[model samples]
Target: MGRRARARRQQQQQQQQRGEEDGGRAGGRRGAGWDGGYPEIVKENKLFEHYYQELGIVPDGEWDQFMGALREPLPATLRITGYKSHAKEILHCLKNKYFKELEDLEVDGQKVDVPQPLSWYPEELAWHTNLSRKILRKSPQLEKFHQFLVSETESGNISRQEAVSMIPPLLLNAHPHHKILDMCAAPGSKTTQLIEMLHADMTVPFPEGFVIANDVDNKRCYLLVHQAKRLGSPCIMVVNHDASCIPRLCIDVDGRKETLFYDRILCDVPCSGDGTMRKNIDVWKKWSTLNSLQLHGLQLRIATRGAEQLVPGGRMVYSTCSLNPIEDEAVIAALLEKSEGALELVDVSSELPGLRWMPGLSHWKVMTKDGQWFAEWGDVPHSRHTQIRPTMFPPSDPEKLRAMHLERCLRILPHHQNTGGFFVAVFVKKAAMPWNRRAPKPQGGTGEPRTCVQPSPAEPTAAPQEATGPSEPDPEPGMPDAGVSASPESAESDGARRDGVCGPPPSKKMKVFGFKEDPFVFIPEDDPLFPPIQKFYALDPSFPRMNLLTRTTEGKKRQLYMVSKELRNVLLNNSEKMKVINTGIKVWCRNNSGEEFDCAFRLAQEGIYTLYPFINSRIINVSIEDVKVLLTQENPFFRKLSSETHRQAKEMRGQTRYAAPSCCVAGGGRRPCGPSCPRTNDCTTCA
Candidate 1:
């Protein structure tokens, strides 16, 4: 065979072996090729093929290539956190150290493709590798690179994400002072990206804006918290709520209560994740028209709710992992119709240059599960109307279709970019929705009070357990399988309509479910804890002392967290109305052994960056060699250190921290300290 044929055969053999070794067993029956396991999942579904074929989304002569790409395993992709000072350093290390080693490496006689920088991602921070995740783990040649990825990912310096999944956040154009919301954020890859964008300028100790990440499943909210905690951002808040009915919250604006509308909203709503089939093999077996048909109403509801909660000039990016029009363009069309011109689709063709995508379809047909097709809503029989709604079909009026500008939306296919399919539609709010044209009334006005039953004092205030393994397989950003009814009554019900009204009066009691979170108790400015910490660290007087808070009310405060002044305002005003699961970054922890040092609280690595700017004293600068020794050795005596470091260590009387200049560690002088120890008075490094 020729070289190309040999490589293709080798790939097929590896795939066959993987299926035999990993496929789940069925009935424990041993057969000639079964090994007591189930047959390999056939990556073919007649219904799926027929449905898409009818949609005619694939370009001419590309149907076979599209199917082939979908069948192949997805390549691994990762993104370096661009806001960090060490981003360039990480990129350099990957290029010179790890990828260079793999230049001549081969696995099972198949040459491995060197990882390349994604052309669209700025600064060469994002990368694409042809190596499958399984090969990265099993191939001895790639072991070192795999370990590097693991370490960096855990440290929040990098993220292993799907390439298409990174597109929505980039389109958001988040800023440090923009109030943003992730309507269905979980397994928070996109949410962390937003946090990174918010802290793009590290000089600002605390950004004026915050991100509120919400999800309906209470348990999944904890997973979202765990992922967000890695970034150590105090401005991000986790809330448990049905996105379609998320309560409108109030925030203090210039000493007056105002309805809180997000400056940017990411409405990546739940959908049938047919686009993620390349990675999630189960999607092939479960793919059907019913999934999208059942989810269209909920998707529309979430998108409408997002538009309602967005500022007049704000932008909302509605995205989905499913390429099905029922879940992509159909929901966008319904939302725009409901808005009555309050929202308009934005043409982002020039946003991410070099990206491969097709314009959203202005004409498409919806199909029932039993091979029934409808070109218009009126074609559906009365009995099938409950399952298929008018919004699921394309508009019959050519003028209306042109006005919707559905073609502005983006649809990325697997073949064009060697990536999983994705859909993104950007909407910019031009005015308030038709139903919510009036300004929000002040609190305690005609609106009924929105409150939840308070948790008892005995409830434990412990943090959620840390994620043990790699991020749990989240359904492509916002793929929830629950709440999939698409009946017309449910879509047009008064409850759903009221949810679209900005700051509407509570139509019904808001039920609070899941574990009750500990109350956020703000520290009094005169609290005894502040005096010693301020004096010992020589903190600048400009710090907002009152922004410090603890989760406990009565017990000794063991950890001190600080939020931006903006987040504090949101928490104080909406605590009763919103289901806040967790917020705040731990800035200080009580050190029982440090009582003699005149300060009981020591700096926490999680919040060192935010606190570093305000600390004017007790900082000991060390050399790069000193940092290496400190990290390598448990206890290195002063004699082993350089002359200057030794002298500085001797001069310090109490517990001391060491820091190396950013330039010495990462070749970046934008910050004073290294990435691992941005600011510290002791030998312990910051994350």
Candidate 2:
């Protein structure tokens, strides 16, 4: 056979061996790499297109291995605390829920395990059981995969290593009411996860609390905001800041060292990212023996900073996506050395099963004071001696003096479970931490940074002159200062009307919709909330017109008043009576007396998505029923006009002489099947 065929055969043979070994076992028995059940394009990058064409996957399964590799085990050490204390309650819940395997296990002590290897994370397993304390619930997904775990949980089968992702939320509950600091939180998966955990518990002991998620880059802060918003948690505060200065944020309250103390902190620092090679193929391309050692200094600084932020007895978790000893053990060693006996690596082996890895190193080497090399690889006497060899910390050094200053610590890695490579080291401040005893809170004397609230109704214009009538002369020719309102006479002439009928020239009013607080709709100083351009409108039917809002008088009030400018120059102008609203962050309008209406909103991009409510509108986060009612009511004549237009268009298109009326060509010709044309059967054609 050729090389490719031989490799394929070997892969198949290995998979077959693993399948036979784990065939009858429950809870997703692990044997080897991937079984043949997975797509073949996943194994080789160059063959992606071949497999995609044959098997039907886009990009030929580009991220196949990165995503698929999560199933593989990593040597990890998991430590679980809260679960052990709640083991009995968990067992009872599982038993009552009809989980026979859980009911059969021993639950007398801190933990209870089945003879079967746990398919779920020990923490998540505990949480699932805890949630079931009140009812018998079976997860259909988990139950379908691993029959041995909890014949019930098979239906809920998520990957086991994903449990590492759940730790923040679970711990957040166990330690609700405590301040949190997530150092190096970017692309904030863990930060948002923590917020979600806190949201899970409504009656947290402490009502006033927030988590500070910090990273070195401003761009990352924006990304963090996006993640936090999606999780919809109110407690997150994204900060673009450095981690090394965290200790300086510690403050003194009375003498107890209470200010700026976090109950839980996570230091998922940057590293060579070796452990994550499964998902991050770039790491494999970029990997080098020197990278981990290079990042060691930065890692140590961040870990030390986390230690400094911990409250007396508070806990911190330092983690990374790299598996190198320099990035993991060496950094922890440096932290302990700098701490001077204030931190301790706690024994976590008992807390989590399937995570029995090595402890922090001690007794490693450094350059001797006599300028002599300690390792056998050292020292060309005088010629090459000019170049300094890298120094090392003790392999078994516990930094006992440094550890004596704190309460606890633990570590986690991926090799222990078939998941992306990762590492974590947990530490706790002593009940009376020894670091600077007291420092100022990071917020400074200015008080905590408050969110920029949109101006309230009562706080209309900052200056009365800014909200005054537009009676002033034009100071700079055609310039109109921002806050002036439109003339009452002009408002009456416009066919577009809101609220009641037009009153006298001086008393005419413009009423805004969906306002809970303010009945009077008027602009003050140029409202930053309003978009620059307003939609056009016309009273006459079938006449096209466009309108632009421009300052009529110069001064502060010029920001408020605007006159609708007609656009007779442009053909088929959208003549809609547009009202821009502050809420909904969008502009709503309807053509002159026409039922068909359009709503527009600006996205992160400068471009806009103008939605036709009358069409099969694809709106989000709102009920379709409610949308239908709102659209129909706002555009009373929309249905009649839309149906007539649709029928006319169809009739025009069906006429062969017209060659299908082209919306783009206007005069009618065959529509070109350009880049967006439907080559395949699955295309959803749009005009």
Candidate 3:
């Protein structure tokens, strides 16, 4: 390139960074260059510089390098979708076939490999390229690699977003049998990961525990379903609610209903998102001191609510796509201070084997265009317009403050990992947060602190009227104290069915799934449709909370879903409180064919994974070759199958990539590239 051309480009970028006109290079869209295509390197934002200097965290010597990294496009990184059947083979295929195109490349006299596996990720399923996707699009050496991504991403075998986005899911430590909640899930890559973790322990499709993925946006909740649907987790229940005021919920244990709580919560809140400058190029031009400052209050409330919803000793990971102090450490500090000893930060350096990260800074600053907002115009009414909160600023005594534990938080900067910048803080609820009681007022009158009233063994919230169910003594001695029922009647009573605690912000939108019907109702055991279907699949009658059916948002066929006992109780208890966008995986679809095994009720692909363990019959095992053929065909029916295999095959012939068992089940679900199904007895080995 000519020197003049480079100089002109640099000058244009500087003007854009200063919030000057971008002349038409960057357009008005956020991540303008990154919507399904390559993103341009970013420019320097001056206010961002002033804000970073105030924090005094970055070393002065490396400051320029840190600043420069944000402007550079992030390296392309992709992870094997963990639960997919062909995940391992796809990983091998990339290294052996596509990546082989760029072998032995030389850059500045140094030999460079194509893609290197991220050692931190399990089984080295993740990879990173030194070159950015934007450059790769134009590079001749990696043409096959780029084409591989294009093909696999469309096939749902790969996710092609920024790599730093993958960090939170890794740190979440989700697992089967653990009730998990993802507050603010959308454009849901992380939620998908959570679902994978929920199903990770399953040899069959069903998991004992399930994921309750909540997002405020109704539309985005559907998107989350689409992303989560790829892995075919039947255990996922997608709901929409404001994270700050999410309602307390209940679930049925054994045969009785009780209040619900989560074992794990992910509070990945929305922020200024300047850390995404590498991918969202518009951040370079739109960056301002007020971005994080304005969002501090909302972020704090979301984190606080997540803490409230967590079970005692449950871990909640708070994260953001922002590098700003207010959004990262300050929000966590404020939550810790408000918890008053109920929360403790977990040191997680040793968690992900080889993950490299920096500790969160104990010290940070609150800055605005006119210097510190709190120290300057904080008392002014106009400052409230910027949504600045008192908790956003540093504490008077840093050690006496919750900010002291900030050192345990993880900060991922662009330069440190060749990815986007991110901040993650894991907190364990040591005890129930003392809500409803006002602390001694602080120096200035700020907005009201967090308030929640829910009953638990440790902290009883508002005492709810006893639900009407079968009268039975508590099964275990301490079960009653923990709100576990001995056994509910056949179902909850009609009169007590609608009981709930009043909480949560008023729903902005009027539409909700299963709002008209009592959402808590389980599928009746006597339902003629379910018995035949259960018998066809050889299911143990009590397998999942199959009786608990909530109408999902995809109500086109009036799709009825089955949720975990805990999730059902939550939906029932929190009904009419927060908006319920969608929940549960559909187990029974609208069908009237009445063919016994395949008619009147079709097993949803989403439900099949969790259903695998409970099913005692009707699952026909196919060879690896058969699995591959089924996965590749849109409407595959095999004549080569045994009669038993043919019976199930015809039933699943027109369905999504479901029903067929690979060496293991995977959907974005696909067939295995290796050996035949490993499930014993349940699958006939295509004999």
Query: TM per model?
Result: 0.83, 0.41, 0.72
Q: Is candidate 1 or candidate 2 better by TM-score?
A: 1
Question: On TM-score, who's better, 1 or 3?
Answer: 1
Model 1 regions more than 4 Å off? 1-32, 36-38, 137-141, 438-512, 635-638, 654-687
Which 10-residue window of candidate 2 scores lowest in summed lDDT? 566-575
Query: Global lDDT of each model?
Result: 0.77, 0.39, 0.63
**Model 1 lDDT tens row, 1-687:** 899999999999998776676554442234335665677888999899999998999998999999999999888899999888778889999999999988998777888899998889888989989887666876775888888888788778899989999999999999999999999999789999999999998788788889999998888999899888878887989988778767766666566455677899999988899999999999999988999988887788778778878888899999999989999998888788777898999999999998989999999998988888889988889999778888888878888889999999999999998999999999998986776544333334534222222222222222122211111111111112222223454234323432111122322333334446677878886688789889877889998888888877666889888888888887876554567888978888887776655677877766767777787765667677876766666645656768986565555543443232110111112244433543433424331
Query: Better model by lDDT, 2 or 3?
Result: 3
For candidate 1, give the lDDT of residue 567: 86
Clashes of 3: 17
lDDT-superior candidate, 1 or 2: 1
Tell how far residue 485 is off in model 3, in angstroms.
Answer: 19
User: What's model 3's lDDT at 224?
Assistant: 84
